[model samples]
Target: MGTVRRRLAGRALSGSLALLGVLLVVPSLYSPTREMAVADREHGSLLSHQWEWSWGRVRVAGLEGVELRDQWNPFGLAVLVVLLVSGLAGVCVWLARRVTWGHVLGLVTVGLLTGRVLTTVAERLGRSLGEVDQGAAGLTVRTEMTQAGSLETVAACVLVVALVLMGVAAARSTGRSTLPAKLPGTPAAGTAAAGPPAGRAGPAGLRPVGEHLTTAPVSFDDAGAGGGGGGADTPATAGKPGRTP
Candidate 1:
């Protein structure tokens, strides 16, 4: 019963982690990790851009006067790889009805690293944009991350927390399954009561029994009857009877 319960709990945790992974992927697809704005000082026109990262693609959208450029960075690619692998692992775990600490750790690490990398990339992109020369055209560029409560950030946090919780649950289940079960009426170690008082007889003249013995006691009356029969047939008794006859 305990083993069954533990397996069920592990499966539940795996399912939860999978759900979290899917949720995390959704926000990554639609939410912009960073926003960029380019302005022509002379023309007074501002161009807004949004960068979104997903499993297989990177999206850049220009909301105003400039054309969006397609670009990829090493860091962005690495983050994408982690996201894809973690998402797939989660799905497999959910389907297989199993979960391990390694899976949980992978999910957690991916989540945390994704957030960190997003921040770092955003900062680097912002810096690079600020340094670009407009080539005699009065142009300025600025970049900023999306709001704190952006869906991507929220999803990443949720995924990380879910993985941590799953790991903890799996660990607890494993610990419980490995422990030995205590049987009913069994004394705990170091506290077993001393056996029935020494030399005290049990039911029907039986010796006091411990945990293992179950034999019935010998009959004292049967032994006495056998002894009397043997005495009646002794040599002296036979001679006396013959002489009287």
Candidate 2:
């Protein structure tokens, strides 16, 4: 029972941390500023010059300026998708209540890798948006991590810690099951190995108290010598006269 409680406690903490990381990822990962390129002008695409990504959504043009004032969640997208991928994985961990999901992690990482293929498309469209730059783009794209709670690295760290804790708890639980059947010097369970106390009957067969006699022993030698038992006497005197003594 104690071990169970401890495991549960550890899992609960891990789930909570994973949830927190996911929540953080819901906010803006990066804010991007883009200048109209010659090709864009020639093509008349008129895409939004500013935007940011969060909650698995995208904004462009007029939509881009909506939350621009929000210091922490400046609008951005692209490499910051790492936050989204990590966030999704964290959610899975929390839901499963487990930390040993290496497969899940690998799958998510592969997904992120595939998504990187879109980098070229984004860069061409002035999608300088990313997790690292954090808006060094001519002060035009600025973000504050404090208020928005979009510190990607910190959030990821918290999730990692949660995973570690859950794994440790699982390891301990497994160890308990693999322990020796019976420890040295420890009495075995059940009455199979138990024995009766001194003078007590054990494995008895027939007779009320087994096959023991209740009477005391007698000395046959003394009885034969006429020292401890009565017997016939003076037979010799009758046959050959008295000895006169």
Candidate 3:
């Protein structure tokens, strides 16, 4: 019963993590911390800018439309891959009701994804605060990550913890399932210490020969007396009938 409960809990956690990851992927996770206004020296106009990070793309918007759009950094790409792989592994584990390689894969995926997101956020925030960009006509602009990115980072951390717990639960369930069960009325460990030693006598009432032996009394004396009496009678009859001899 305990094992069954653990398995059910593991499945529930895996499914929940997988669903959360899928939902997070759908929404825009990254948004600019602050709007940038750059002065156009030639036109004397102020241009607005915004930035967003997606799966493998970094999008920058200008006053009119998209200004600079490109692929994400290698670290960001790796994070995206981890996120995708972990989500898939979680789903598979829940559906198959087995751990196997999925546990290790999910653990690695969550760790990498969470670590990358945290590092990236920290680096971006530090750079945005410490450095300044000097554009045309000495126009200075700085940007930092917003709450959306931070929230996503926090979610990634939570997902990693959830995956770890899921792995633990699955491992426990697997162990319980694989262990041998004791039969009814079977003695537990060290309980047979009082039993007989090997090659010793068994229980009472059982014999190797299987049956008891018996003997009958003899009558040698009676046989001898009857023989002597018969001999004497024969001799007396011969004496009485010897007159003709």
Angstrom error of the Cα, residue 150, model 1: value is 2.4
Worst-scoring 10-residue span by lDDT in model 1: 236-245
TM-score of model number 3: 0.55
Q: What is the lDDT of residue 235 in candidate 2?
A: 23
RMSD per model, one decimal: 10.1, 12.1, 10.5
Give the winner by lDDT. Answer: 3
| Poorest stretch of ten by lDDT in candidate 3 | 234-243
Report residue 47 deviation for candidate 3 (angstroms).
3.5
Point out where model 1 deviates above 4 Å: 1-14, 26-32, 47-69, 73-82, 91-149, 183-245
Off by over 4 Å in 3: 26-45, 48-50, 54-56, 59-86, 128-151, 174-213, 216-245
The candidate that achieves the highest TM-score relative to the unseen native structure? 3
> lDDT tens string, model 2, 125-236?
3433452331233223332233333344355556566556655655665677699998898887865466767566646664656446544443334444474445343122
RMSD of 1: 10.1
Question: Using TM-score as the measure, what is the rank order of every candidate, best first?
Answer: 3, 1, 2
RMSD value for candidate 2: 12.1
Candidates 1 and 2 compared: the better one by lDDT is 1
TM-score of each: 0.48, 0.41, 0.55
